[model samples]
Target: MMRRNDGCTILHAAVIGKCYSLAIGISESYPDLAGKRNEKGKTALHLLAAKPESFRSGSAYTLRGLGMKSLIPLLILRTIIYCCIPVLYKESQPVNSAEEPSNSASIHKLSRRSSFANYILGFPWLKEIDDARQSHAVAVMLAEKLIRREDWSHYVHTEFKVLEGSQFGISSEKKNRMPDPLIQATRLGIIEVVQEILSVYPEAAYTFDGKGRNILQIAVEEEKWFLYDYLMTSGTNMDRMLSAIDHEGNSIIHLAAHQESPPSTPPGVLEMMWEVLWFKRVQYDSYPYLWHLQNSDGKTAKQVFETNHASLREKAEETVRALANTVLIVSVLIATINFAAIFTVPGGFDQTTGEAIFLKNRRWEFSLLMFYLAGGLFSSLFTMGTLLVIIFLRFETEDFYVSLPCYYVINIISIFYSAVLAIVACCQALIVQKVVITDFRPLVVLFFIYGLMALVLMETSYVIFDYAYHLIRYCLCYRGQES
Candidate 1:
């Protein structure tokens, strides 16, 4: 029944402590505390909305894929242990009620606290935090419970009135603005809270923050890609929401084009490419007129995007140029080596016949040697030519969108093939020489060389393949749009 000086009740304290049992018990017994705001005008749910780590959507992605295999057995063990807690508690009870301590309530509280602590300690990898999956479940359940008892309309009105008062010079009793749980959740990318609020009162989606931005706009501004997509497809008033602009007269498209590589984007994606993808995604979904529509700053969405990405484009150009120069040097060296290899002849020319000695003694070996030598030389020349084309071309920002990536693909592939052929030709030359070996040393050397080649290829082509993936996707999307 008592509250802290900050106006926070025991319900708020329980939620903050992440004591889910106490929080749920409090909500069930004294539901009114669920809606009570502290001095800051934040209820228990409002505080929870700001904590992204409590939800699965906000959990670290490192514990996925391969990590899941290791976690499965631990999760199963935790479940088994959790199921046995109640049985252990009942079995340990005193046989006679009279034998129980006068301070039995204290023991019960201590037991509950100890059980929760044990649950947390079950996962060593979890550290001091609860398992994300379990925390997420409790979060959803608490959100659902609060939403069921909340009168959302009063909160919505208060938020709007706070904004309206500041705008029209009307006085209000509450000076500091309270954060709206749904809007705060959207900003933090906590989709569970937003979803729960909207499911109960879909009209809450239409509410705006102090800056006159609805949840959709906030999602775009904060780069909450998943939440933005969800809001767009949640079958709300799409047209109205899409057309909604902030007080600054910037639409969702402008907001989308505003930021680069927000935390939501994958780390490996190229910055310029990620920026372009975001702008294009927003452009495609929004009305065409919005593309050229000027915001309060007298800039269109495209202009804002280009302005924001100017440095990224320069960096991309420099990266491509540097890669081309380095690869060009390697290609030239490969071409020289392979060309000379063609003339030397693996087993030297027969002095009398004036032909390769291998041609007469080992005709197939000579032919294979010539084939690889010629292939390596030609492919190296092709690589050098492709790289020259890329280096000489003007690296305009638009060129990065497609032209540079196309040339890079050709350059990398050709150089890779040339290197492989050159190595294989050298191995074939050893065969033509019929070099003597005692302990399978030659085979071991060959395997070692091939292993080095594989490692080098993987190291070199990792970034190239990443770029090529996004490039291919971009091309397909462009083609589809045109069609």
Candidate 2:
């Protein structure tokens, strides 16, 4: 209504707080001035005219007492603060009129064939030919690369099969046969397309082809190291290609270890392979260490060849040990030092006793002693324990009782060390720690370090391997869906 009166004063209208709500209700009776605006479509002058009229007519508003009428502008200001801005906010946001991607049927359909096919076909490829002709291997690799280009497509189709074969120079019995194309692709390291295909064909990803090579083994043979590592790691089979033979009973590691030169399985290739199976700590059919793993000929990976190959095996062993055990080594050392240490290290001899009881010795020994102090040593319990046990064990013979005190003292010291180590490793990760079967010591720190490293290796292997496997399966799924 004030708007209808051509008032410009927003402050006066706001200061008279309750009037705004009343104004809102009375507003519908008149034309919406906001809509029926001036020729310039502006209301800038409306506010100025309204304020002074309110101020001038309010002379009787001087109550000289306590009534809400005296506090109109303050109340209006409060009301504007508490009410006005909030109301405006509610009207400002854009409404979500667009629907969500919600059809289960369409989702399932997309995961089926058409999308997979489209992904496979849609991906662009590099057309460079490999130089070394010794490898029909290269052509096979290219063919696989071309085939993998559409991996996100959910199903296998004739065109994909044709592309797969044409890329590799290998023909197949049927148009939609998946093996040869993927085999080539796996060999080629065509990751993008492969991932798309496996998203749809998860099960098929694990299947083996005519040469008795699963796509994984084929990948290894084709020296597609990433695929080999992925297959070894995928958690599908920790032992997947460990024992897989390439027409001769040679395992994948065997082939890798047997590469005729210095860096063994190709410098960069080993790294890719390692990433795939880095965390995988599969118990070898024989021993845990690759240096100790033997082939069908009963030769360890280290023993695969006599000279340079042996060096390669040694290097692999070194790498494995270093990666898997570094954490455990450091932890164990810290834990060990944190574990043992009762009497003070002899900085000098005991002059009063006149006997050379040089107790604590080296840095490692001192480190071993540190564990108990860190644990807020309940050593007093050990002292009390020694006294009690000493009494019980040596009541009849006091001479034997002397030894009993000594025994009790030794045991108390030992137990404190044991408990501290248990606390550190267990407290750290909160894993249900395996019972440490071996005896604990400073040197044992190395064992703990090695174990942790192996655990990391296996775990890392598990994650990446599983991811690659999914990618492999996703590629298939995408392929099928595309088809």
- Give lDDT per model, in order: 0.70, 0.35
Candidate 2 weakest ten by summed lDDT? 101-110
> Going through the candidates in order, what is the number of backbone clashes in each?
0, 84
lDDT for residue 117 in candidate 1, whole number 0-100 = 62
TM-score of 2: 0.24
Task: Write down the TM-score of every candidate.
Answer: 0.68, 0.24
Q: What are the per-residue Cα lDDT tens digits for candidate 1 across 279-361?
A: 67667777776777788899888888788777777777677778789999999999999999888886678789799878986
What ranges in model 2 sit over 4 Å off? Answer: 1-179, 207-211, 219-229, 232-246, 260-298, 305-483
- Residue 354 CA error for candidate 1 (Å)? 5.4
Model 2 C-alpha lDDT per residue in residues 1-483, reported as the tens digit of each score: 334354433322432442332232222222133222333222221221222222211112222111223333443343333222111101112234324212101100112335554465344420111111112222222222223233322223333122353322222322222323344445445543345345535544644455445566555445554455466545554343444444344445555443432122233323333322321212122123343445556765434533323344345444433432443343345444434433333344468875323333344433433443455244333433444443343122122212432443354344434444444433321211222333355336656665665444433333223334433443453311110
